[model samples]
Target: MIAAFLLLLQAVAPPGVATQVAPAAPSAAMPTASVPLPPQDWSGLPILPIRRSATIQANTSMYVHGEVMAGRCAKAVRTAQGWTLTLDLAVLATPQGRFRRVTPRAIDCPTVEQYAAGVLVGTPRDAIDLDDTQTDTWYRTSMTFTWAGS
Candidate 1:
């Protein structure tokens, strides 16, 4: 049983270095531009948890409310508690595991975009992990802000 367990562990662990393979030559019939790109692989990237702060939550709620009231965004659905704001973002990380950039998808609300970027920027370095083989890559992530009691 112990030998089998050790074999399983070895299979699960990443190899010290990845083997490289050359790309196949393109055929004359198919154009590279027409080929659909594969979706990004986010398996190894860290998923940072949302750290809620009362002050930040209050400010974001106020900003969201103002945006809704000013006709900037469609009326937000409000529950007995309050409204929820979600931001989808792509974060670029360097080979050294440092976060380089935070890009938020255009949601028509500029302040909200900035808020999401701010949250990503405030994340500590220790929270992210990167392997030397990853190089520079963009990882997709999201944050949802939910305020209760308006």
Candidate 2:
């Protein structure tokens, strides 16, 4: 009777049924989360241009390279929070290639004078001056125009 019962148990069970079942694994470290988006636009809307003022300055050797060079000043307009102004040492007709350098005090004018003179916010050592090789080292600068709310 005992041998018959053992034969019945062996027939019901598989060879390695205990080994087949694995223990549950602990969960991984909590995954990192993404940053929240700004409360502004999420739709693929093109940004409408804000009419900010612009001032462009070119180097002394600007016209020597057979290129038309000029310094430009544009008028400022009012904005919602505050007005913003832009100053860039840009090339007019030159493609994605070499151009001239506009030093910090290079293009001094009444418009950019107060901002430049107040306190150079973020320029590197000695301002954006000419190196021995004469390439434009892009040091950063920023200022707030509080005089006329611009």
The superposed Cα distance between candidate 1 and the true structure at residue 52, in angstroms, equals 11
TM-score: model 1 vs. ground truth: 0.54
Question: All predictions: root-mean-square deviation over Cα?
Answer: 16.6, 31.4
Worst 10 residues of 2 by lDDT: 90-99
What is candidate 1's lDDT per residue for 1-150, written digit by digit as tens? 324433443354233311111122589985643222223554465544334422354665676677666777653667777877777776666576555556667688766666556555555555555555456666677766666655
Kindly report which residue stretches of model 1 are placed more than 4 angstroms away from their true locations once superposed: 1-61
Best by TM-score: 1
Q: How many clashes does each candidate structure show, in the order listed?
A: 0, 0
Task: Estimate the TM-score for candidate 2.
Answer: 0.22
Q: What is each predicted model's overall lDDT from 0 to 1?
A: 0.55, 0.27
